[model samples]
Target: MESRFAEPSVLILVSLASGPKHGYALIKDIEEVAGATLGPGTLYGALSRLEQRGLIEALPAEERRRPYRITAAGAEAVQAYLEHVRQVAAVGLRRLGAAHA
Candidate 1:
């Protein structure tokens, strides 16, 4: 099922792919990597969904902050999704270049 929160979900997954991170770390990482800012609600909501889907798992709470890591399944999913995006981007760029030429 597609989620209205797809973008944030993907961003979170991608960030976690790098390493486990708590909510605030995730926010900073995602912002640094993607130039997108996720508010607390959006970050937590996507984290819950990812956890429920078995794509991510939360580690033990450390100082009241829980870090999350991507599962093997999550890594696979993100790789596939990014490959598809790359293909689409390449085609779009090629078409734009052709039109300009």
Candidate 2:
């Protein structure tokens, strides 16, 4: 199945791939990798959708903020999505090579 991960959701998932993280940390990491900033509401909204889709789970509150971890199914979905991207990239590069030649 196509993951259809939106930009924010994909960034969140890629951030969570390393480990569980609270909202603030996710924002920082996503900025570092994605070069885009996510406001609190946007981040939490994506988090909620990921949770609802069973791709992620909110951990019990450590204090006021809750952390989140990726589910196994989520991991699989990310992998599949990445593989599809890789294939697309390879094809595009092949075309680029031909154009360059």
Candidate 3:
């Protein structure tokens, strides 16, 4: 199966790129950032996959809350994805041709 990033995962990584955050913190931040709620299973699954892929790392455990940070690869991937989104938007806007509307 081809590995693909869910939108929530991408958003989570971008949020963490700024700094480390614990699980609930990440969930709250992402919900605010994306205006969507991520279920517990989905959130944990994404975090596990991201860590396994080396795109993120868990910090030392502090109680039940373990913080995570975005790896260098994660930052690069997020940047590239954002750039691609911008390019795609430009193409779409150009195709619309404001004069026609």
Candidate 4:
């Protein structure tokens, strides 16, 4: 949870917050939304960790691809993390504006 992989984990969770998606869909969604391209190694590594932590669960494979969905705990964790990010960004922006003024 607390590692260099945290960002990717959060991105994955946020992507799943909308609905379930397979590996390739998750990669595309993260790239499109966050402008960060996750290689297969990084994607699957984080996926493994998240699964171990109970933040996500893999659904039955559709042909060759396995879709994943965010659990309730995953939603709660992501919501809290994002809220903290929003607060930090708000403060930083306010300070920057004050300094400029």
**TM per candidate:** 0.92, 0.87, 0.85, 0.92
- The C-alpha lDDT values of all candidates are 0.92, 0.89, 0.85, 0.93
Off by over 4 Å in 2: 1-6
For candidate 3, report its TM-score.
Answer: 0.85
lDDT score of residue 77 within candidate 4? 94
Please give, for residues 1-101, the per-residue lDDT of candidate 4 as tens digits: 32234489999999999999999999999988777888999999999999999999999999999999999999999999999988998999999999999
lDDT (Cα, tens digit) per residue for candidate 3, span 1-101: 54234487787887897799988998898777766677888888999999999999999988988999999998998899889988988988888887578
Query: Number of backbone collisions per candidate, in order?
Result: 0, 0, 0, 0
Which stretches of candidate 1 lie above 4 Å from their native place?
Answer: 1-6
TM-score between model 4 and native: 0.92
The local distance difference test score of model 2 is 0.89
Candidate 4: worst-modelled 10 consecutive residues by lDDT: 1-10
Q: Could you arrange the candidates by lDDT from highest to lowest?
A: 4, 1, 2, 3
The alpha-carbon lDDT assigned to residue 17 of candidate 2 equals: 97
Colliding pairs, model 3: none
Of the pair 2 and 4, which is ahead by TM-score? Answer: 4
